[model samples]
Target: MLKKITLVVATTLLVTACGSNSETAGSGSADSGQSDKVYKLKLAATWGPTLTPFIDASQNMAKMAEEMSNGRLKIQVDPSNKHKSPLGILDLVKSGQYDMGHTATYYYKGKDLATIPFTAMPFGMTSTEQQGWMYYGGGLELMQKVFKPHNIVAFPGGNTGMQMGGWFKKEINTVDDFKGLKMRIPGFAGEVIAETGAVPTTIPGGELYTALDRGTIDALEWVGPSMDIKMGFHKIAPYYYTGWHEPGAELHYLVNDKAYDKLPADLQQILKTAMRVSADDMSVRTQHMNAEFLAQMKTEAPNVQIKTMPPAVLNELKAINDRLVGDMVNESPMMKEIIESQQAYQTKARNWGKLADYQYIKDNQ
Candidate 1:
């Protein structure tokens, strides 16, 4: 009886050891999976909450990033004014102070003039054309070259399709009226405005409303009807103008090179995909909002006058813009490359525009 009892106890002990080993192996595999995972990122943007589409897109990007990573990667976005000036956002991202940022490429002209092609030039391609160039015409690769030295990876984020010409306290009936007008303009456009006998000032968006209200600025140009309506420009400045000069204005999302490189290959792809989605969503939202806002403005602000800039004014501005581009190309080889690429793409795209976009607008009008 004693021998049988001892044998049973030994068998039970052996089974327990084997079970323990199996559980250990399973735990090790689970740990290996956990070790491969990473966590959240931080993104920044210069625009405020009032820019609903941008804010919404950014939030969507964060959500998508988290989902794509299976909760391993997360992105936290903050307003630029909360941390740094809008113009300083790109630099902050490049330095790894922020994981990512959204801002205007033109705002960084002092860094590289090639950025102008990525944003807007006087008489540049419309929003759709610019997107085609960026996605297919090698514009994205060239932009990468420009930003590589700065240690940032840039992606097209949002666009304000054709902005207003500007708000004028008085009608700009002719080229002479453009002379001596103090307009709040930024980037290369400011230089072009200066050539037209206007003094261009760079002011933060938050402060622009007050400047215009107080007559500190004689004229001001912001994004489009949607943004203009949100800013309540019609209340202060009764004259609203069309965006002939800036046919399409593009915005960008810049990511820190090191931070981006650290991400897994799948995560990197996720970021790119998120940006493209955001870009398309933003464009659609802006178009719809502008149509609605324009209708609302017409009813709400009946006294607000909407007028187009004179053809003579546009012609002169175009000439000035050409000179500006030439001077910029002379300043840097990168600018030269960008200009060549842009012109090549423009030539190709303009043919389509002439036959389709331009003709449609002309016929419809």
Candidate 2:
């Protein structure tokens, strides 16, 4: 795992297992390049290099693809620092400017509202439930259905289990406290918060710390302690809130339709399998990092207060979230199918999980 996978623009391009006589897997190349052929891929990421769970997921995917394909597939990951367009990864990949991209479906809600649910929905499925819904419960089909028109095939790249609500400069006790509050939040969660009269600002990952430090933003939600620790938000914000908005925020691995079509059968499967492994690895890694970083926070940043939002405020947000989804569903036929599918799958999955994992955790806590 220590071996480097690949690099990008102003980044190193590593072909780890390339034979000395390897050929290019280019479309017009003579050698049909099966054995020693190297397919060079460029992947743009929405996360900055310092963002762990996201960056780690991208690297792991590249490594898996390289190792599995014996260097036939080499992906160079370019973070926002390199690309300077974290929020625009979807466009980068869709335009074929990049072969692939690591981003969340929710970021492009303005372009396509249907992209929202594939990432996370406020008060929707938990991580486990969402994973089940995605693979075994017809979730991937719906996701593909939404992305097909965009000319990019989206895959589940990574998952951050139950995300922390955010770091707040002040505790939110009542519903009125949300009004006019500026926060760095993304996805549909931003829209959900905006419903409470709060202004939701989508800041790039690298800019969040400066934004919070300079009082440019009142609060922000940047994953859990794992990723946020590097941002040092705890130094400025004392109140760390529990999650409600993003129960299971999922990252997306987007592949350009034309690019993916060029891959041979074996390499295509290898790429898909690599993505699957990366997705699962991120979930486990996130859980581990969250636990370790949280402990680190308690010891180093002792002043940070971990608090849950008051039920009154949570109820208001939940109400708004439900109304928003309900309205979206009624408005878009595709949204209705996707939501109905998710609900039907998640409800049953949650019930089954509740009796075992849920009860065990609940009783112990």
Candidate 3:
């Protein structure tokens, strides 16, 4: 009987050990199946929350990144204070103070002239055409190469579409009106404006309203009708000008290269997809908002006059832009590569636009 008892006790112990091992294996598998990994990133923007279309578009990107990674990645976007200044945001992201930031490329011209290409040039491609160049015309690769040394990866986030010429205190009837005009313009445009004898100052977006209100600046150019209406510029500056010079002003999102590479492969893909969606959303929203705002302005601000740049002024500005671009290309090898590639793309794209867009607008108008 004792021997039988011993055998039964040994069998029970063996069964318990087997069960524990099985449980351990199951637990291990469960832990492994939880999810891939988690990466928390902070995205900053210089534009305020009131810029609904832009904010909404970026929020969509955050949502996409989360869903694409199955909740393994979370991008937390901070509210922008225009006080931080758009140009300052890029350096902050590059230094790892922020994981990402959104701002205009032209704002960073002091750092690298190549940044101008990333933004819009005078009489450059429209929103759709610019996107085509960036995505498929090797512009993306060139931009990546330029920003790599700065430890940042830049993506085209948004476009303001074709901006209004600007608000003026007085009518811009002749090229002489540009002389001594204190205007808030940045990047390459500022350079060209300087040639026309305008004092170009890089001012923060938020401060523009107050500046114009107090006559601190003679005139200013923000985005188009949607943004101008929001800022209530029509009250201060009565003359609203068309935005032929900017054409399509592009905005960029700068990501820390190290931080970006640390993300899982799936997460990287999610980010790329989100950025593309945000770019498209920004364009669509801007187009819709501007159209609505234009109608609203007509009814509400009858005193606000819409005018195009004088033919002589436009032609002179175009010539100055050409000189500025040529000078930049001569200064840097990278700039040369970018300008050449963009010019080639623009040449090809312009042909199509002339055939399609130009014909349509001409026929309809």
Candidate 4:
């Protein structure tokens, strides 16, 4: 009887162990279908890896997406070098060649004039105002409408608060100074400034410093101190004028509509939130970086005199900008709607800001 009991217990133990192994083997497919599966995406940026603020935005988004998704969703960011197509990001993303792209909306104005207002305008809203308008005052809606035709979804990636006007070899003391001046300024601002006889030319980023140094271009407007310091523009052009052209030059991320639509609901949320947070982060980081570098400029690059464009010069530019915008507004029904929407929002926001932010600064300064 004792031997019979021992044999029965051994048989039961073996049966239980085999059952557990079989269950574990069956669960592997489910694990592969769920938690063990990974999704990889590719992103392209208009900037190289080291370019601050712009490239920082792209890296920040990728890092956050991977962390938040527990490694399920991964994004590989490729800069201009890897792709060798900086100017074609919009078209690439539009055609679903890339999953997403980081670039400026204004870069594509030749294809669509309506893209100008999304980035900035001469004498337009500030970074604060533009951001507020985007989140609260239907600016995002208008941006989407403009980009929808191309099958691209646009989101603000970062902003360069208020860029310095440009670095010039000579001071722009009078409107007459623009006469016969050649500047490597592009976009709508290029058109506005052209009215003043400052012939506008478009040059690639790599060639800008050489162009300025060799007198190929009399002046060029890059970003503020953080970026400008690295370019050594201060050594070549002493006059650093404040901005009017791009009060808030906002950078954007372009996602292919189909690629975005295919993301799981959770991943879609992660991407959107990550982009929003990183964009805000980029704004604050850029401000800090610019401040740090601007201080360095004062001590190290003292010859880099920071000056504002005289009100007279600003007025002239403003007038030309208004006319150009007016012509754009009359072009299409959609242009009229987008421009009108921004102008409407600007009117309401500027008044409150005037008393709140503008007044405080004007009084304190």
On TM-score, the leading prediction is 2
106-136 per-residue lDDT for model 2 (tens digits)? 9998899999888898888888888888876
By lDDT: ranked, best first: 2, 4, 3, 1
Instruction: By TM-score, rank the candidates, best first.
Output: 2, 4, 3, 1
lDDT tens string, model 4, 16-53?
Answer: 43233221111121223355457787899988777777
Please provide TM-scores, in order, for all candidate models, with all chains considered together.
0.87, 0.90, 0.88, 0.88
Q: Give the TM-score of candidate 2.
A: 0.90
> Which tens-of-lDDT digit does each residue in 1-365 have in candidate 3?
99557534543453343343221111121132436667799888876776677666667678767865678879987757633545588788889988988778788888887888788888787877887898778877888888888888888888888888889989998888889999998877888889978899988787899998897899999998877887888888899998766788888888888788776544565576666666667787889999999999999899999999888989988888898888888988998998889889989998999999899999999
Clashing pairs in 4: none
User: In each prediction, how many residue pairs overlap at the backbone (N, C-alpha, C within less than 3 A)?
Assistant: 2, 1, 4, 0
Off by over 4 Å in 4: 1-36
Candidate with the larger TM-score of 1 and 3: 3
Error of 4 at 125 (Å): 0.5
Report how far off residue 339 is in candidate 3 (Å): 1.2
Give candidate 1's whole-model lDDT: 0.77
For candidate 3, the 10 contiguous residues with the lowest summed lDDT are 21-30
Each model's C-alpha lDDT?
0.77, 0.84, 0.79, 0.82
